[model samples]
Target: MNSITLEKWSDVVLPIPARYRAVITRDHKILFHETDMTPFINQDQRTFREDFMMYQFDGDNIISIVIKDMPFPPTHFDTFTDGTLLLASARCVRTDDWIQKNAGRYSLDGECLYKFVLGDGISAVAIDDEDTIWAGYYEEGVYGNYGWDEPIGSSGLVAFSSKGEVLFRPHLPMINELYYLNIQKANSIFAYYSLFSAIIHLDHFGRVQHSEIEEVMEVGPITIINESLITYDYHSKLLWSLKKQEGVYKKDKAFALKDQEGNDLYSEESAIRIRGNWLFVLNDSGIYRVELTMRMLEE
Candidate 1:
């Protein structure tokens, strides 16, 4: 029943009606594939398409990139450092003779520059300035689901080069699946995985350091703010926060989110995305945002 007030970051005027595939950039811009269909699920069992458009809205300028030869519907996408895009689908199945390659790189003009297999049940995908791809998988991708006798993401985390070449795979036999991770643009990685609630920080030099926030678990999509960990409160359908100060942990708390006018924020379950210190919510109403700060932890 507790409520947290948030400062609005953007307008409710949704530019594209295809809200399911929308993504918000760190700078507050919006990007999404223009479609009316659901996302993350296999489209092969539904509507298959040979083409689609990716739209980016930056301020008043709109950039549209038309892609040909769509591979299942894209479940995750990230822009490369060199302005290209790394887009991939979630589900992949093997039929006789032909294998499904669901991930690919596309140019700004929407050309299919390269295609690769990122495995199945991919939960998250991120890229850094070095053009290194860090893909996180769920239980299915880690446990030989989707016709993969040997899942490519057996480690639950896989790093690939710009050309889809495997670069590094860590040996964390404890983690059964990757839950959430923040792979910063600088190649610094902070991840929360299954069976282990402790956050792991992976540096560029191949060193591993378990973070100090083991007090906080993957209750939902994880977000780091100052010295606190935040996720969603499934019951309240709002923000949940956990704080660590001076190496001491605080009890977890949940609170509802509202705008300056005290309007309630909408929750569509899968439409919530937390990045760095920002929370983005998508709905038919539009994209809403809130900044995560120390104040949220106090409430």
Candidate 2:
């Protein structure tokens, strides 16, 4: 089996008491979430929280962002170049309550500058280089769920301006559910959605293009390794490589995730994540990474 060795970042330590943590692959950063839970009993006896904190790690430096008096625990979030934070949550049952917006813009001091509904079933949220927010929705989000008569993400993918204005929505008919979204810079976007298994490529000026891959990978996003496409089956932990042969991707090489010394990672492979052409694998041994390049693929 073809294998690639990961470069272990042995110096880095994932902080203890990390809750709802995720790697911001494109930004090469780690995000951690923590909430100050204070149960508030409403008239109907429903409990609610009102404060949260987001800890973002830039390599060895930790940037702690605290937002108090506004409890919006995000499932996906990232900061704009201007340092303004955009955060989003998923699948909320209280869609009728406009105050409990699933997404919002917050200041560094944890003040809610503005709040808006991103609808339900948000699988992914990404902001581009130009600070345009992109939200990817699953099946429930598009078809309308949680008291939504007209879902905000009816197209499965949506682009919003920095101030929360709806900018662009693709008219593609194949989008019933979006699984993956890779917004590279402000000019390019890559997405995989629906049951069609087709990859959509779009430009900043609204140009659209796509390529279909018949082979289905049940899990993980599409990772481009040099000129080939990589798809990992998290269930089986089998990684497959594909090259475009006559306009379609065909599987050629296979791999199993290994350590720096080429040791079997086994269950560790399940935590492997792809951001652009790099693989970020984190386990009990700490964080490890490997850059997928043309030279390494051909080796």
Candidate 3:
């Protein structure tokens, strides 16, 4: 076995009880935000409802969480250089008041370009380095049949101009997520397999350029950086770094760690992410961060 080291950083305490569907953006600054979800059933009206909240983070600290009376949890978010932020939910809601309240921080045409609605809520969003908005939704047959008679329809991959005009929409069976390939150029987009098993490359027009899904041991959470892909399997606490070459593929074990003594960490169903040098592990208990060191693969 390879050597390992694990250091517990801090616990992110959420005020309102909610499950974190996704983590949009993170940095070493005071401008971080996250989406919070709340599920409630109205006894008077007998209806189900969901709510979303925008959290502002200040250097490893959560300063405030602005709640939005939305029907769905936010799927993704993007911040502009001008201090404006765009939050996108997987599905449409009954109100956009949250956007209105933060209007002054954003540009006049911000809503026209930054806001959106998808046919379904299983969507992912990303803003390229140039500020173009790219979104992806379920494509029919994208996810394996839930039932034989269950009909799956086209999952559309869409790109919008900075001003929110639909630039392109390509019919696909499904998409995992949208990413900006800064190393490739402004015209390329990167999406991962919904289950974090593979990476798909698309152009600005939603065209596939390349794909790689090499099998890794103990599959976990995966992230794409330029041409490199990293997967952190929670089951074994093993980090796998997959590298792609011109016409060849290879995977190498990068790091390994064990869960802390008091916490019942690692879940077969939960997702994981490696940001910078920190590994984020999320479960029903909330999100936890640990510092890890990469090791050379041994024979």
Per-prediction CA RMSD (Å) = 4.0, 3.5, 7.5
Model 3 off-target regions past 4 Å? Answer: 3-11, 14-19, 22-52, 65-75, 92-115, 139-156, 169-188, 194-197, 202-209, 216-220, 224-228, 244-250, 258-271, 275-279, 282-299
Predictions in order: lDDT: 0.69, 0.69, 0.45
Error of 1 at 184 (Å): 2.7
Report the lDDT tens digits of candidate 1 across residue range 104-132. 99999888898888888788887765678
Which residue pairs come into collision in candidate 1?
none
TM-score of model 3 (CA atoms): 0.58
Q: Is candidate 2 or candidate 3 better by TM-score?
A: 2
Question: How well does candidate 3 score on lDDT at residue 214?
Answer: 56
Ranking by TM-score: 2, 1, 3
lDDT of 2 by residue, 83-144 (tens): 77887776544534443466788877777888776667788887888888888899888888
